[model samples]
Target: MKKILPAILLALLFILTASSVGYAADIQMKVDGVTILAEVKPEMKNNRMMVPLRVISENVGANVHWSGTEVALTKNDRKIVLTLNSDKAVFNGKTVLLDAKPYLKDNRLFVPLRFLAQSFGCTVNYSHTTVSVDTKPFYIDGVQVAAVQEEIQMTMGSIVDELQGHAYIETMYNLLMQNKGNEVEAPARISLNVHNRLPGDYDQVVQIDFVGENGDSITSFGLYAEVPSEGEDEGEPKVVIYAETEKRWYAFSSKASQEIWELNAIAGKNGFLTMISNTTP
Candidate 1:
């Protein structure tokens, strides 16, 4: 793994340090060429760039968890632990001192940008007040991901929302990858988990397209609940995912199925389902 700071970035840091270390209104952050949609904007504090811990970490393919004043971040083989108001950080079990301490702002934990990013083997560059973070391109099933497209499985398929950020894209991808099911002779009765069923399964709630650089879908899949028959009680969970390209089916546990439903429901709430049909004409 590359060390946290390089000479050129150090020089850039010096230039940024000379500026007013307060509001980050002029500072823009981009990861892998996509502007980060951070709930709290990145700010400059104590000559170091402070960014929301979760927002920046997730963008670089790192998972974040907060336990009171302490937060843990992990990606691949690396793990980082930091505490609020402390300059000390544990990287891969080795302790190191940070140039600045992390602090809470508006209930969000903010950490030094370069330190947390480099810990995961990403490069950070500062130019014209925009911080560009470049991470090794993430691939799923050997295909480079460009973005994630969410679609409504209504009468016909209609795209409702899309997310270009690596953080969001990776999340939707994992929901499919992690819950793969055992191969079986294709089920006889496959139903779509939708509000109003399609001619067959039109309204299958979970419709995700992982797009590549050329704006073509690398893979697509849908999931539906396979609840037990009236008499049955114990067996596979309710979720059954079908990978359209591979023509494969997988059964996920009840817990996982519930989570999938919640995810699609959340996406639907943000999409045309909320405004186009629910309230408007």
Candidate 2:
């Protein structure tokens, strides 16, 4: 009887864990400083919050253009075209590889909001309770900018319900000089931190700083990336990076370095950093 009782308890625990795999998500709209609730649906295949693209674009006053597998967005006369199934994206007449590809699911085209927002001029914000999408005169630390990307985990289930699911948020960022500005590279200071209520599996926080020449500083920016540690199904990395660039940070296994060593090393000597985080173990 005692052995049978223990086995039953174990089975019950497993069932409880499996059942906690999905939760409700909250959606919001942000114009200026006011935020209101928006519609939300479950993207079953990807487990993402399926938001209405039309509502989002219209609320922000962005003109949307679609042609077969391609979607083009025009705002303030600036244009960005994304083609389905293609890794390359066209922005302002320049061709570049998209960090995240656009896709069509259930008759709806879904693209990463960060890409559209930043390429145009917009910003996205996420908190425990709300996701604020703002598009009017937004700036970071006093710099008037549109669209920046930082990584945050979109909860599959309601936080109040405490559901456990497996998913990851990885982002990529690129900085290009404006119109023959300079071909120089610069040393940059970069740092990443993950914020989560539960202990994250890959709790490793790495920072890198580097130096750059005068022209290099103009092209310097940081990419913040996070990934779930292997074997930890419930863990997710919530990352933030502090540097000069448009936001959208990506997740990767490599350590973070100031002025990004791998990238700068390829471009040769152009930039440098003076001080960095000096925390000892």
Candidate 3:
């Protein structure tokens, strides 16, 4: 009877393990309205849903690092640290107990989806077979400038002009030169706004606006500069600018272009101010 009892317990454990696998296979996840097709699918543990760490973190623009049995996630100002098979997690230096501890499944680290999403300021909803996550957009605020500088011609008909203050000014000067016949029109204005979302992984928005002579806006364009957080080596950041007139988006990683665009944005604002001053009574 003792031997038979041992065999019955072993058979029950096998059945439970098979059921867990089947349940995990049916789980799906969606982030920001986009379905995540992770190489390792999500799993269920202790009535909680566990998702692949890399798949979810990358989708939500979080930086993830793994050391031995510990995983670290950083998004903006918040940081989360989780250890394998541990129900305790450190969030921004505060220890919090997790409903379901992270574990390794199929050689991948699976973390509790609801806990992670909420920690990153995202809302999570679960249905029969799907988990949906939504995060609010970041707020943006900034300042602008507009000014003009005189052009100087060097010896032997060589045109040399000092760029005065910022490259944005030079950008504005070029815009004015392109519309030489329309000097009465308000010059293009430049602006720089910071995206306040993820603390360590924020972005800067640079904009250029062209205004009509009657104070109406003509056209507007801008670029987004993605900045990485401290202690992170995210290679080179990216800049994505959309040209409304052309109906196209341009993305690059050239530092020179980024600096020129930033300076030009400031200069553009200054130039517009100058134009207004000249036309005022």
Candidate 4:
């Protein structure tokens, strides 16, 4: 995975280093004289400029596959594959020898970006502040649909609401909005464990809320919890909620703290509640 510094820090670093480093002039080439737009990131080092090969390749509707030993570039109707450690490259059935070897610096693999871009009939352009690649748009999956591979474990529990079955887990309240704005409010239901830490009657209340990708409020629901024990002022155990929808948000809150903090905003909405032990004779 490419290590990403915070955007602000990365920008600042580039500015501080730019003056002492040589820069590349913007140059654009075309495949069959067709123009395409691309975003370029460049670096100046040792009185020379360097660009990422993968970035240039992929920007021009080409795919780059590297397995730590070999690299391959492929696109519809064309293919370029090569192996490293032996100074060999193959372009569309034409084998060629490299005058120099590709090496890694600061964990990034560096190669001749211009050569790769031109090999695919694409043009690369660079200004003092930007690099642009122009290539035929390639067909691939949109980034929004990719599945997230991060693993997060969630704890689940349930608390009975009322004696004699007077109360039960409520159905998720569906709150419809008329404006159809990005934000919506909806009810949430989750099973929770009910146990009082101290000997006494206690009650707990929980709430849920959803935050969308744009950092907008979507939906929120409040839950009421009842237990039998004394509540703890410090380190009181509480429940957190996790949503399991496609591209959903993972919501989190704590009744122990009596304040809600978002656990995972990238997932669907979620919430939590505080419970004090309730004692009943």
Instruction: List TM-scores for all candidates, in order.
Output: 0.72, 0.38, 0.47, 0.33
The better-scoring model by lDDT among 1 and 4 is 1
What is the lDDT of every predicted structure here? 0.69, 0.42, 0.58, 0.39
Ordering by lDDT: 1, 3, 2, 4
lDDT per residue for candidate 2 within 1-281, as digits (tens), equals: 99999999999998875654433333444434444333343232243333445544544545679897777877666888888867788998899876666667666666666566666566776665455555554322344332222222222211110100000000112221111122222212222333442233233233221212221222223333335444767333344433445433333323333323443332221111112222222
Question: Which portions of model 2 show Cα errors greater than 4 Å?
Answer: 1-21, 27-51, 138-281
**Model 4 regions lying over 4 Å from their true place:** 1-18, 22-40, 44-49, 83-87, 97-100, 137-281
For model 1, how does the per-residue alpha-carbon lDDT over 136-242 read when each residue is reduced to its tens digit?
76587788998676665544344456655554466567767776767544556555444433232312455677889888988987766554444666465455667
The TM-score of predicted model 1 comes to: 0.72
Better of 2 and 4 by lDDT: 2
User: RMSD to native for every prediction?
Assistant: 10.1, 22.2, 18.3, 18.8
Model number with the top lDDT: 1
The candidate maximizing TM-score is: 1
Worst 10 residues of 4 by lDDT: 162-171
Better of 2 and 4 by TM-score: 2
Question: Residue 34 CA error for candidate 4 (Å)?
Answer: 16
What TM-score would candidate 4 get against the native?
0.33
Angstrom error of the Cα, residue 137, model 3: value is 2.8
